[model samples]
Target: MEARTGREKQVYKKGSIRQVAGCVPVNKTTKKILLITRRKKKGGWMLPKGGWENDESEQEAAIRETYEEAGARGKVTSLIGVWDHNVINKKTGLPKATFSFFEMEVEKLEEKWPEMDERDRQWFAYEDALKVLIKPFMREVVEKCSLAPSNKRSKKEFSESNINKNLKDTWNLKFSAIVVFFAFLIWYLIKDNKFISILT
Candidate 1:
């Protein structure tokens, strides 16, 4: 697939904040996040993100960015949130771009990609992935994923385990109360023989 290049037909040339779409690609089983090398200066790892054309939605743009940059794609999930930051674009002056980052549970990583000649991709452990990133907003995306339980399968399992523990505790407490009530009844019968005799 050919990568979309240049400032071709992007949204918000007139608007104040330019809207960019991004993806946080993760492998749930390996618990790793995918990061790609910067094609130009700065020469550090970052998430896959870029501007979409006028026609497609932000989600579609995000998925496209992921595949184009990282050569990875999968189930494109929830939007983590929108992040706003300034960019020193020569053409646009000092306008900020708000990136709508989404989480993608990556299923496929290609051997060759459209921009493979310019960029390289690798997978990193969740926390380590956050450390390698230079952009604050990109890090924010990973951090948001870390805190969001629904995004991770392990988090969902933890939640289920917690619920089971709570139920077990409740059952134990009820059992103890029943045992205590029976003990009190037996003790009262022994202490007051006249009460037991009247019952008989």
Candidate 2:
């Protein structure tokens, strides 16, 4: 998965405020992500997300939406990030709606769930999930958090760890190449020495 800074490129400052919580439910054991499709909408796929009432916390809202939309529940590993986009509210005015995303480790996939008739849920491989997602930022968030859910690390921490690991691997590769080059050089010197070959 690629790394992204998730810039707020389309945030609206005026009109009513809307808050939504979304979850990228993952199963590290199977390395799959849960995606949902609207009953009437075709082709496009999405993570479990919905607006929350004032009484619910962001985390609670996310979990609830996951169950209602995806029919799975588990621990929230991290607050992935927030994305804002400009949209027209009911009053026909522009508003910046915030979508707060989180990574959830799915513990179970129930046989029955709310909105089962209105939504279709399925597990998808990381790559396939990216292709089905309709929103670009949503895909970015998923890719950023697509690290194994068991790691339960924040996106920033995970990215830094990956950077360090990649750097170490690159250094080791370079060192190995140099060692192989020197070994071949020494072998060639001995093999091509006429006097040394005659003595052996």
Candidate 3:
């Protein structure tokens, strides 16, 4: 689907606050979040956000933005709260946009998305995400995102996360074992024959 680029259907709040919706797309474990690069790689990286359209609720708009900008589909719970910030001539000019950021548990990731050419997407550990976020409002969204696992993910996804984590741990253990074995072999080759007698 084509992303909505024009503000014709945008939802404005009060008189000047432009309503914007975005999401902190994350794995079921909430260990990492998905971020999208700025169109020109100017803002570094940011949560998938855009104008809240007139036809959709804040939540719907947020999820839509996640799919369009981050190429993620997932489940989001209630509001993670909202913040209001002013835009300063990077893209949307000087209008103030009121934002509602959701904590989304990503379920499906598409290889091709509407904004694929416009942006690049990646998953980052929560702490790393904070470092690349250029906007203060976006940082606030990360800070407010719940890190506690909800344990609400579908069994299949939850198992997948566990399996992935286990595999990583197993690899680390094997790597460490190899390093230790090589170190011992080197030490044996250099040590005096007296030290070898203890092991024999």
Candidate 4:
């Protein structure tokens, strides 16, 4: 006896899938993560990543994007994870995307590179980098990497809290300077007895 068939096959739309690759370049010795800022995005921050080329493998694409965006060349040590989520493409308004992330250790950092004008690269601690990341899932990935075992740990890692404190101190210093400048101006006028003359 043949059983009644009720199962249905799943079908994917043509040209609906997009592939991307990126890496998290971490300096374990310094406990710092490198990040890049896109020129078009203004204040937005992101990991170095891009779409795969037809002739390149996923890891190759990841390495190329890292170098292009951050001016850093390195080897992908391990596959962190493969993540997929919908993103509305600003140009096409489509929502199909996938990304493969890897753990990378920076080997050579060049003073000048292809994307020096298109992007700005900087280093931040795990927490501070997480704060500036534009994507939530990427933050998740960073958090996971921060917990992973490392062979070395540094004495000091840059912190956002420290940055805020430095800014506050700098403001106080500038304000103090201005106050002293006005105080000196008043003193000079009074010493020369010119203040009252000017008022008269």
Candidate 5:
């Protein structure tokens, strides 16, 4: 499944195996989180997500799914967390399967609707979205968003450590240079005097 503009296209074959998906919510300037309603589905007010295709990786699948469901385009900023849960088909009473969830940042929002399969789409505040989502794990994703940093700190910390190491190296080099200069001066002075040189 994929979405462009506000329309969603679903190309997957029916009764396929379980697949991965992304639950993406965008925070607009007004602090509203966009939610997409699945057409004809009971629990529609949810994040955009879909299954992993044959050639696409999990992250790629997430990107495709988010657009397909929400009609919002964005980049996968960070992986907040993953969850494994059973989805029972309401009509068949059979276990649907497991799904992998990812949190993403919507890069673009268009007022024009895309030609897609989703029923409706709208934006709401984080608190309002929490009330509408049907699954408990979906809510957990929102909570995790609050804790996860906007920019990942691990990479920044690693770079800082490298800089510190480099500075320490430079300091050691300067200290060694000073010691060598003093030693050379002492040796030269001892040799300058003929008496001291002969005594050595």
Candidate 6:
């Protein structure tokens, strides 16, 4: 795999299936969610996840990805679900992709970030984090995290918060865009006919 600025290109063996793992770390006492901030890729706020290595169990792979990406340590508690999605590789036109999901509550939250590559790691309240997660499924998984055996928050609480945050973010983004558009229009009107010609 070649690492570029905010992108990674990985080469896999032909006809080989790839396995990936992720962790959904929820704080038991605070009912907050933990997420790692690595560089964004493909326009998504991705989780700390990666492919399985030689002879590594799926669970071990998941744990390793979590540590490497998030600087947190935990054990796989349960299977949230598996995602088998396909993407056409533009370079090869072959249906190249990965199948991945997460193992929930695999381990307890660590007090200190693990010594690894420098990545910003932080925990957000369930509502706040969902807004930043690029994947809808991630929001869904974190909302469900409170239902895990180790979670302290009630399921209903997380569900409501998740929904509310989704709505809030939607409206906020729309409103911001509208405001920017209007500001640009006013600027154009005040500037001259050249601005109008450019828009047209």
Highest-scoring model, TM-score: 1
Residue 186's lDDT within candidate 4 is 93
Residue 193 lDDT in candidate 4: 94
**lDDT (tens digit, per residue) of candidate 5 on 75-159:** 7766767665566677756555446666666778655444244357778777788899877878777666632343337657879
* Candidate 1: segments with Cα more than 4 A from true spot: 40-42, 87-95, 146-200
- Clashes by residue pair, model 5: 3-68, 6-114, 7-114, 7-116, 8-116, 33-124, 74-107
Clashing pairs in 1: none
Candidate 3: C-alpha RMSD to true structure equals 16.1
Once fitted onto the true fold, the runs of candidate 3 whose alpha carbons sit more than 4 angstroms away are 86-95, 148-200
Report every candidate's CA lDDT.
0.84, 0.79, 0.83, 0.76, 0.66, 0.62
Which candidate wins on lDDT? Answer: 1
Candidate 1 lDDT tens digits, 34-125: 99999842479999999977889889999999998889979886888987665656776756677889999999998888788788888999
Error of 6 at 111 (Å): 7.9
Candidate 6 deviant stretches above 4 angstroms: 1-17, 40-45, 89-95, 103-117, 147-200
Q: Least accurate stretch of 10 residues (summed lDDT) in model 5? A: 4-13
Best-first order by TM-score: 1, 3, 2, 4, 5, 6
TM-score of each: 0.70, 0.64, 0.67, 0.62, 0.56, 0.54
What lDDT score is found at residue 86 in candidate 5?
62
Off by over 4 Å in 5: 1-17, 41-44, 87-96, 111-117, 147-200
TM-score of 5: 0.56
Better of 1 and 4 by lDDT: 1
TM-score: model 6 vs. ground truth: 0.54
lDDT score for residue 169 of model 4: 100
**RMSD values, in order shown:** 6.1, 12.0, 16.1, 19.1, 6.8, 20.2
